[model samples]
Target: MKTPLSPKSTSGLRGEYAGAGDDFTVEQDWQSYSPEAHDRWRRLYAAQSALAARYAAPQFLEGLAKLDSAGGIPRFDDANRVLQAETRWTLVAVPGFIPDAVFFDHLAHRRFPVTRWLREEHELDYLVEPDVFHDFFGHVPMLLDPRIADFLEMYGRAGEKAMAMGALDMLARIYWYTIEFGLVREEGGLKVFGAGIVSSAGETVYAIEDEAVLRLPFDPERVMRTAYSIDNFQQNYFVLDSLDQLIGSLVGLDFGPIYERWRHEQPLPAGQLQAGETPFKAVRLESLGERTP
Candidate 1:
């Protein structure tokens, strides 16, 4: 992968934010997409859907069915039709990434900001920055689930407050380990749920099936103190038993004191469990040597 990370932040939208002032939203420019771009969308959507059907959460697949964007690049208006009809959520067009404040505000209001561009033909296997396929294909489908929808909205709201406490790093970790690369247990087996995993072909294979990456039960405090990679497959993937439990995890967070206590601690290594946690035999990797840094 030639990327620094998947599209984690909304701030990299380049200069297109100039006109939107603080909101940073723009038209989808649905007609401006070249035939080649749409073709890229078709190919990526086909491949990812096939892979995700096997690895993605059931609700994620359901979202894709509802959105109906598998055959080609979907118009923002069209996707909104389904999103609004089902979840009362909508996709907003953006130029690549947007500022965090703007991004959170959009999410807080049930609006998902999707980038309107596609990755180049040359970088099909991997790209440095997130494209339309990653944002929409990787993420949108799962938004249909009520718990995830509500959880994300709360995340955005809490995130806005966390920023004032100078604890955005702690908050971003929650988004990273949960929203971008989270796993969930189903039928006693772990399955992929994070956007960063389902969208990437390699990760879709490596995350659940690899047996090389350690899987730990979700712990918000541990997740906040842990460091993660922005450039490669993750060494540690957190697992949540259910969406209700995930939402429950945030019920009584007093992040200020937690942040102050662990804020300056050395980041937990990506490949190792800390002192308080144990490597359950069922979730431990098959070969620790195969893990990444």
Candidate 2:
């Protein structure tokens, strides 16, 4: 028999929906979407696709192409056909952000919870909360890559332990820095792999081009101890040398010592380097003979 999903509070969630299961999943009901919604999706796709080609990681670009989502909001079932084949991942519709444990449970099982609603047209450039466009467009493409696919499952598995240890804050920072706002060195320059960067047109340019923002080399411990900003563009981005390094760094690694050591320590401020730390100098896009769009 299937385990019953426990009741969860919906307070602070912004997505409009009804009939969510105990797990907070709802049917995509793809046909119910209005033409205006589809058009909004198309506009978002058109604008972000251009930025992605210029600034996004090759894996993201390849995955975006494979998903074929440029026309409108993609049917989850259609995208699942490709996603499941590529990485055994599938999208499940949800009203919005669910509880952390529920969210982690879905990831642990390779079920990604995508919000079932789209953002308003006026809110295109920025939305305070993640809408379907942010979840599906920004996140699902990376799920197609095996490295990220594996890492996310591992992350989900780690969540329970984190919660029990009272270390969710530390674990969440890892997710925030790497999965949501990560940068990677590719083609002799920095390219975005983070979903947060890929989905926002303004941030796509700002993340890579802005001289004011600090880019730091990926250090799991430092990342966990660092604070992040959700209300604005990230002041700091963690740069990975390669996806392989990201996987290898955390696989079979114990976070116990790190958490124990730093759990009581004050969080490092975002955007400021600690004494004796040096920032990573990104290879300029112009140096690679690529023009910014």
Most accurate candidate by TM-score: 2
For residues 133-228, write the lDDT of model 2, one tens digit per residue. 998889999999999999999998999989888888899999999888999989778999998889999989889888888999898999999999
Which residue ranges in model 1 land beyond 4 Å of their true spot? 1-21, 280-293
lDDT of 1: 0.78
The RMSD of every model to the true structure, in order and in angstroms, is 5.2, 3.2
Give stretches of model 2 more than 4 Å off.
Answer: 1-7, 16-18
lDDT of each: 0.78, 0.87
Candidate 2: TM-score? 0.95
Which residue pairs in candidate 1 collide?
A: 10-98, 13-97
Clashing pairs in 2: none
